[model samples]
Target: MAKERSIPAPMANPETEPFWAAAREGRFLIKRCTACGKAHWYPRACCPHCMSEATEWVESPGRGTIYSLSVMKRAPEVYAVAYVTLEEGPTMMTNIVECDYDSLAIGQAVQIAWRPTAEGGPPYPVFKPR
Candidate 1:
């Protein structure tokens, strides 16, 4: 297989460490606001919905539908960037991989696939068409 394309490691902080840690373990997670019962990505201390500071990390179902996509044919390797709307209703930015780039489409079903990167901090979450 081609070397996995990598994004830089996220700088883990107290609030987001749980997310980074889970990624290292080949799992995906999101922050769910305890007060508002809303799930969100880009882990944070406060809920974007109700502005509540109460949130907890929850395992993501690791499945989503492609909300949008852009193919990078000129890159060293063909790749796609996409916003995947997760099953729990949060849209997260991720890459769509392991298939022909021309085959991807908006609303295509996808599932998370962890890829180890050069950064070595945590394997990043990309997706494969489901």
Candidate 2:
């Protein structure tokens, strides 16, 4: 059997460390503002809506729909990338895997998955048909 190649893990800073750490344990974290009850992406320290620093990290259900998608046919291996709107109400950019690229459709049901990264750093979220 052929060996699989690894991709570089995402770089985590102070602001995103918690999210990445939780991902290592197969958990997805979302932040909800204590002030406005709104959730935002990219794991900022403050709520983008209320500008409040009291955001709390909460576990996500890790299910979502494909808000949009594009297949990169030029790649040596075909892959589809898309915006997934989580059940928690945040949209994140992710790769759709474990299926044919042409099978992807907007609003299709999906579930969050994790893939190991290069150099044994951490696993990152990907999406597969649910």
Q: Model 2's lDDT to the true fold?
A: 0.86
Instruction: Give TM per candidate.
Output: 0.91, 0.91
Q: Model 1, residue 4: displacement in angstroms?
A: 4.5
lDDT string for model 2 (35-63, tens) is 98888786889898879999999888889
Q: What is the C-alpha lDDT of each candidate?
A: 0.86, 0.86
Candidate 1 per-residue lDDT, tens place, 1-130, comes to 3444657776779987888888888889899999989998878999999999999989987999999999876545677889999999999888999977888999999999988766666777889999
Looking at model 1, the pairs that clash are none
